[model samples]
Target chain A: MKTQTSRRTLLKKGLGSAAAAIFLRAKTARSHNIKRYPNSCGVLVDMTRCIGCRSCEAACNAEQKLPSPALPFDDRSLFAQGRHGSKRRTDENHFTVINRYDPPEIDHPLFRKIQCNHCQEPACLSSCFVNAYTKTPEGAVIYNPDVCVGCRTCMIACPFYIPAFRYSSALHPQIVKCQFCYETRLKNNLLPACVEACPQEALLFGKREKLIKIARHRIRNDRDRYVDHIYGEYEAGGTSWLYLSSVEFDQVGFDTTIPHEPILNSVKNFLAMVPMVLTIWPPLFAGFHLLAARRARAEKTRQENNREKADEDV
Target chain B: MKMFNPENVHLPVSGSKKNDGSPWSFQDKVLLGLTPRQYLSQLCRNRVNWLLVLIFGVGIPLIVQRYFYGLAAVTHGSNDYPWGLFLGFGLFGMVPLSASGFLLGTTVTLFGRKDFHPIERLALLNGLLGYFFAVVYLLVDLGMPWRLAYPMFVSLGPAAVLFLVAWHVATYLSVQIAELLPALFEWLNRPAWKHYIAKISLGLTIAGIILSTLHQGALGALFTYAPTKIHPLWLSTDFQWIHFLCSAVFGGLSMVIISSFLISRYASWRCGKEFSSTLHDITLGLGKGASYAVFTYLVIKIVAIAHDNEWEYLLTAWGGYFLLEIAIGVVIPLILFARGVRRGSVTTVRWAAAIAVIGIIWNRLNVAIYCFNYQLYQEVPHWKEVWLTVTLYALYFIVYRFIVYRLPIVFTWNKQSRKP
Candidate 1:
């Protein structure tokens, strides 16, 4: 057999290019880990408590000093507005938006707030080639606009599609998304604008560990009312922003099929092979050249010997 | 090895010269041995020149406006779909088709296939331009075009798939340029420069393979980051990069056939006797290679589906689209190529090559645009975006012609002959 298939060598000889590339990938990125923050604070959101109030959205806009939204904060009419078959996602103008999901036989619609999930292992942080994203000690995923080249790769990498670009600007384009109010609140151990503005007490602020217990306790206490699970406990490797809801996650526009592991885990295998290819492919191809050249030389010598014999006879 | 020369072309291997045995001036070289008046007349006579003028009139302004007014001026400013035709068609679509350089490089230099020497330089040039212009397309799409070095020199996200793509493409572009250095030296008639390149050709060829292997696969690996966003059929974590790399082999080879077909048809003046004589054989060989690659790609695609156990997905409308893609790009081309190779039918092979190129482009577009966020509503790119994409492509064509017109690509330089 031209190719060897012994077990020790597959891992020892390397799965060749793929395994080595993944193995040597991101040697410098060990410092920027998404799992470093265990005691970092997080916000647990209870969907059952929300009343579709526009107060939190208004507070977020005011706190960020963002431009007024196209529709007034008090307007519930925007719930019917959708373009290109999708509802209003967060954009450069707004960091967070709530979508109303009407459950059948229920008198009122369930208002689900959509914002950056602030994943433990964030897709945005991993995908940004410029290292523009920073997963802070306080569990908020912050972005540095100055370094952002605005490739918009973060948008595609994001499972929740949270990162939005300022494509309207020609001179300077920046990615706009929620930072969990890192600068104004989370860093200083204060409540974020949206959390403080929640009149229904739907937003709870605590350590991520405590938030998990709170989520479980709530689900266990209300067996029939709650869906016995925390939405962000493991989705995309556990987002800092956890969710509790009465309805199925899909019905409320949540992407639950996303692998429980971090998005980076999906590509880790390929990255491991990069180093192997860099080291192995060069020598492998060059050795092919050496072998072919040797054969050509041997053939040349044989032909020359035959020609010499004919000349001697003549 | 014998040098390539197409006898059907205008102007012989020798440059236009004075009767006293002096070579033509720089101006004459630029004119491809034609006089100033003759060159102007030739430009005016060609229909392609007129089309170029029309494209420049519309395209240049949009390109300028894109920088002046921002991407929103020339594209449908959709924040949801950050990448449009510029990246989908230009970077992704063009890069794979340009893979011929390394493929041919490894075959000729590494494997010692001397018979394939005649078309190696052309493949190298094609690869160089494809990669160079892919970067050009990237610059146009980047929000901060000036900070392109950020991935390399500035804040580094070495862990990211894009980081690998950026480094590999940048290095590969340089490697491709080095691989074509001998041809450039030959065109300049500097034998010493050509000899210097010959010394390091093996290294350059090896670098080309490693870089091309990674970056081409890295393009697909870029999608692996978005597991939930892209359609499942298009996204295979285990084999996504392999699928891309395998498909690229044929994508690159088929492109050479298509480009050669165009050259044989339209720019016959540039080819020499060797090129003309060898073009048919080379096309057939490339077709055979493409058939094998397409078959391999089809198998791996099925394996990916099986590994993921996504058979039920085939029952959906998306499955029908996937089947259609395979039928057109893989099955039809595979059948035509196998028959064409056996019967020595260059026409069938040519048709198969064209189909394969289209199939590759369609696949890239499907990944980058159509099936991305399949659950979300579809996006029809702004008309301006389409025009801008066409404009960049036209520019690529113009540069290609300009180089082919002067370079020792399809023809070898001959010292014995004097005067054009």
Candidate 2:
């Protein structure tokens, strides 16, 4: 019995070690290749310069050929209107919305525009099961409606809660969000419609690296005018869109709790365990099956031998 | 069924032939060896059938309305909450409950526990149906039900956690079907098919373990993708997968116990003497196994909260809610399971199983819906959405009953009919 137990232990150890070696090799060869594109262009939204003009909103609506709004873009009443004490979010009807926030700390109401940040490693792109989302080299996190199975996992994954499903369409429901005008404008090396439409130069489109330098330079020159920290510099592993604000970003509807790392970082541990389970479970369970089967066979043989000996004695 | 099952009654067909020795046709087997009128009469006699009819009568039209008028017409269709009761209750909730298939498979086949043989097929059927209905719920909730196979065939994203979930679930569903095929082959009188499945049953069981481990964990890993969205108490990125996997151990077993207890009470006539006599011992044995799993799950859940340094979150209102969930869902069930198994009280164990089943579903709902977007306002599901979720569950119950009644899941096939 002692010898049999040792043999079983040895077999289990052998299988475990072999599986570990394969798992280790796979782990090294594939250590989460987080694709970071250089020379990607981005938008720098300096909120101090914006006059709360609805020009960008109207420009986006016309540029995207979206349905006209119930109240015209010039209407200021939309700012006061909200659902569940929440400000207007990007939905299928609207790609980008500039919300007016009246913080008590400051005397004036600060107008903040909300849209997709288009992260360096976009959560939507990472979480999409069909590879429907794409973070192009040009800094746009575009979505392919053709390939989308519409599982809505992307919506759950987005830290900023930007992606909204077009629930009205029974046949062709798809996620609607700001794409930086990737197909019509960014692909042609032109500024996005919203940036081009900003009459006060509040929205600036340039190479992401250059934009970061310019944003830093502006903060260094005028410390009192803008917050020292750039909103998207490292949020969610650095979005393509950066923000300079007068007050703390959270006071004006920003999600301050977003981690500095990419959303994929949260899931990487489980993803790492996947290969190990796929590699090890089969051999481990099979070894158990073999041991149990062998023990059962041995018990049967021993019972038969004892019965035969008793019969001879009789 | 009880009213219909007389001592000399020829209904509730257990074998391929009548007592007079004429072979029952396929139709007769489906009707349980009763005439069409008798079958309809028996169905109408049961009050449960009337309840089922009422649910489906309202539910089927709502389901059709959902597809025709779009999700916005039925559900709140809020952009903030992309998933509602359907995925929360149906997919996440049902998948864990379905884990009984692999757990029992590993026990009876891998560990060679022949005493559990009587309940193995029933567990497998439960697992299979739970998973099958989860997909049905997916089909209903998904925006594009037509493209369900795209993840499998058209395109692939191997790096995503959901990709792993999709592939493993699809593969595991087939593995479960193959594992349960022997019972179907026995009912169909195809000895050849049964023999072939038996030869490869070990491989299939091993495959079941591999797929079940990855996907069950993957379901929890799905929440990890939204670390900031879900409350800290519910979301521990490092331990989320293990939390899901560990809890499923008891969740699946508890579901089996609940189903088995219900069957013993309501459908005793369907159970053979062997199944009926051994059921009490089997319940005790299963209760013991479930208690150990619940103990492990409770420990890990505490360990997760500690590892994430989330004790501070417990002091808030959310913390109070979290503690309530732990006490009612985890602690109460664990204590009941332990006490029940120790005292040899099957009734107490059954009660524990029932609470555990509801508790597990409640936990899944909390993680997916209630605690999700913790800072944001809660998104209440529409009444139509709730109706649809309950409707799908009723459909699941019906499918389960239909199969258990017809298949040799609760009872052994008569040996005399094996050759014929």
Candidate 3:
């Protein structure tokens, strides 16, 4: 009797697991396709044209209404003020920073300005548990302070290390980052403050598709002057802001080791397990409990029946 | 309590009646049948209480300063290293140690391992307090602690890994509380409540197993987002979740062994004969379980390195440090637990459990802080931040002790108390 019951249960368990596998496969197929907007705007930064002028920095401060800098934006001494032998980063007060990186192989120092990359599939948007981050159709990654729980998972998720928290204000702390001037300028189809204020004509703003074409054309036209690679073209699933550099990107403080795929790709394997475990574990373990209890009961009943037969024989 | 023992002085308030056959009141149970003055003296007698007082004395003011002045006042407030000791040592470190609740729950309730019934309540209580305190640590670390509910009610990013973590931890906490309600009911002499919990115990255990498996994995999956930041040797997106879940199995069981060992040694006066007599065998059983888990964990760690082709990293200095962590945290504990269980040496197992507990915390800290941002400079936590972390754990200790003192967690409840 026990052997028959065990065989039936084994069959049931096998069928149940097969059904779960089918369900899981169907669920995962719909989740991996990330949508892309066709008409997103982007910025093309020509690093060779930049002459380390701080006009864009000044313009960003004024446009964003940020606090006045400790040293005037014109002060060249700020270049030497990198803490821990590292470049200055975006913070609560500043939306962007231009760091001076001197390659040993080059005659002149190159200035690399960085802010939010606003990836095609933004890690910040995907990682925010409260929906605090959004990748706008305009190719801007924006944050809603009202909905943010300030868990700082976005900070961890960002490959560019762009988001900055307002650690100073306990009452109204928020994540401060570049939103591509979306509210004040992007919606009006005007150039971002930094791009408009560039004295070098180093910053070019256009449709992301057009910008990519323009970047390729410039690289092809001046093959000796510029590196063959277009930074951010496919990096982290292709950021909105692209860079053209004279030297290797790693020499100019760019993290050359970043994966070409989106950050969400790495986490998908774990997320796929969530639904599978939730659906399968309860029934699986509950079945085990029932089976164990049944076995226990069967053993007790057989012993009792054997003892009664022994007494009858006596 | 030992200092003022008098003949005919009935203590611990185990049953409904006193030594003189008088009924025990609520006050008697709360005070362990001691006078108000005696209770205060007993509290002051314990040296551990003094250390807790000292921690809170400094930590409470620092906590108040953090709230008024912001995170910058307490933490280094590094934009690069957003998480510090608060999260590194609190959330990641504590959560894995708390996995005991579901592991033991499944063993006793689902698998019908009736021998494990003696230590089941202690495991459940350990999990409940560990999780509860982890939330406390999170509240302190969050930028807008008030908006904690926003993820659940105000806004939802259901696709995120953290979304799974948030939902699973919340539900698992409730499930754990329900699973342990029988002990609470037994202590309160509420037979009806206990009986009700008995009906749903199986369901709660299954829920616990499911929730533990996911969230334990989700915590590791959180680090996958920072693949570029963390050192490659420590981060394996393919097996990160499995690494976390498997380690948690030994971490939780080891915690139970450590806790039971401590209870049997230091708090033996409060324990019943059943708990005291069988604790050695139970420790061996738990140690055997932990040894198996640790062995599996060791294999997976090696497999993770091989899968990611990170063997070259072992030749570097960072690789050396990683190897040291595995040696001290995983390998040593594995060997000790294996030998101790085989030999039935409870002392060896106890030492192994202590080391394993620290090893798991070390692994979490390595992932969350030490090995994070491998290219950037390291950020050491502020003194205030470290103090606050200690303060929260001290408070956790006090609450754990408070519950163990009053409830029938380490000891069986007197079933006859309900008859009167």
Candidate 4:
């Protein structure tokens, strides 16, 4: 009876292990198709064309229905200081901001438009466990405040430092960022408010492929006027918003050192180890348990044999 | 306190019980076996109560002020540094220190190191409370603390590293609770539940290992999202997770050592002879593990720098700070651990463990706050932020003390069975 029970247990264990292995393989296969949207919409901002106008900023504020800024949109003194400090950022009150960079080499100041770059593979979307973020087909990275836990992880995960939290709100809070106007405008095939409001036509909205081509064309045609490279063509795995600047990208506050690969790629190394640990740890630990139990098992068997011998003798 | 000690010297099993043998009531237990009047007298006699009163007198109102007015009332309100001391110390620092659950679980259940069984329950309790309070810290820092569950059931961002961390940490918290159920069962005198947990112990342990591996690595991976912002010396695309995991091994083990020492010193009344006797040996064994982990961590740190070819940054001021962190946090504690292990000095090992714990905190803080946005100006945490962090940690301490006082963590159960 004991032998029969042991045999049954061994068979069960064998079947369970086989089933787990099969499940693991199937899960790995399914994970490959989980890439972000490939044909998402994008924007290209040519810094050479920007004349330090804050019109885009005002348009974003009005479109989002955010509270009006302390400084009026016509106040050019905000640029003369050339430093917005903590005020110059995407916040609960503002989804985008334009910062002026005065480089020693350039005669005129350069204006850099700051907003969510909306990477082809967004870290914010991936980092959200509740799935509050989505990358639409139009390439606009959007967020749902309803599902937001206000964990502020998107703020941490954003490679472009775009997502801002409303920390002061004790009752209701949400992350603020440029969503490319996905709900109100982009979904209806209308351009984002900021892109439409640019009087100088500094911002171009279209398919990411076309935007890249357009940005490259402008740079190639006016090499002396524009920088040799198109920013965000590959940065952080190809952001939707491309940039062409007269000065170097870094000089205009662009983080040029960001890798071409998506930020998610860096985390993949660890994620790959998750399934391995889950699969390997059980059997490996169980084997150790069996080994550790060996001595105790042998001792129990010896005691049983002695008791049986004594009973026979009596 | 007369009820705490029986005048009669007989009945060894009921050494501290009254002659007419009855279990102490919950209220009586709280009073430490003293009468109501005596309990009040004892409370009044202790000078520590006055200090606690003074602290609460000032601190509680400040905490209330935070809730009524908003975070801006207390914090510097700098958007440039969204995360302050609450996250830097409470989240990043506390989580790694709390890795003791997975470490001890892997030790006894996975590696079959039953020799270290005496203090296993304490280590598990330490882990559970650390994580529980880490979440509490997270809640206090979150803008919408009430909507904390929105990310789990409502929204699903499977692609994000933070999403993975949230899911895994939540799942792992449940796993750790389940892993700890055996101790709870033992305390509750429910042997059947203990048996049930033991049956599925292997599965629970494997789950713990998997979740811990991902989340600990994910915390480091979270920083990888800000490649240009974080200091180049700390950011290694290929080895960031490994660096985190390796350091956490030492961090968790060292935490266990420190906790064990504190319990042994302050709560000897609560500890059993077996725990007290075996704790020193376990400390040595844990120190050995910490040494091995720190040695590997040092190697990985070197390899990460080399792999990134960030040797040129070594001449910069940030590089000097990195070196300082390594020297003070890693190298010094490692030397202390080695010497303590060789000499069989429990005191030395205990102090080394404390230093190692601090070192781990320093390392995590460096990654999360100090060296982050290297090109940007340094962000000093707001004074209110600092106070709030301290208050939250003090609450963690209180909870820890409460559990340790009541649970069978430090003390052994069923001592009568061992009697010949």
Best by lDDT: 3
Error of 4 at B376 (Å): 0.7
Task: Flag clash pairs in model 2.
Answer: none
- Runs of candidate 2 exceeding 4 Å displacement: A1-34, B415-420
Winner on DockQ between 1 and 3 is 3
Sorted on lDDT, best first, the list reads 3, 2, 1, 4
lDDT of 1 at B267: 71
Scored by lDDT, model 4 comes in at: 0.78
Model 4 CA deviation exceeding 4 Å by range? A1-40, A80-87, A295-314, B1-20, B47-49, B110-112, B182-193, B414-420
lDDT of 3 by residue, B141-185 (tens): 999999988889999999998888888889998998998888777
Candidate 2 DockQ vs. native: 0.73
Model 2 has a clash total of 0
Task: Give the Cα lDDT of each candidate.
Answer: 0.87, 0.90, 0.90, 0.78
**lDDT for position B412 in model 2:** 85
Write candidate 4's Cα lDDT for B1-420 as tens digits.
223345322212212233344444556445554668866875677665676666667667778877776677777655666777777788788888888888888888766688788878887887888888878888777777777776677656665677677778888889889888866665555657788788888888778887888888878877776666778898887788878888988999999998888877876666778888898899999999899998899999999999889998888888898898899899988898999999999788888889889998988888888887777777787777777787777677777876776556777555133322
- Better DockQ candidate (2, 3): 3
Model 3, C-alpha of A46: deviation from truth (Å): 0.6
lDDT of 1 by residue, B1-420 (tens): 011223213353343344345665667667766667766877887788899889889998998999988898988878778889999999999999999999999989998888788889889989999998998898899998988898899799998999999999999988888888776776676757777788888888998999999999999999998888888998898899999999999999999999888887877867877888999899999999998998999999999999999999989999998888889988898899899999999999999989999999999999999999888888899888898888888989989988887788888766444434
Per-residue lDDT for B1-420 in model 2, tens only?
Answer: 666667445656787666666677899888877778878998998889899899888889999898998889889998999999999999999999999999999999999999999999999999999999999999988899999999888877878888988888889999999998888887887757788888998889999999999999999999998989999999899999998998898899999999998888988889977889998889888888988988898888889899988899899999999999989988888899888889999998989999999999999999999999888899999988998998999989988999899899999886354332
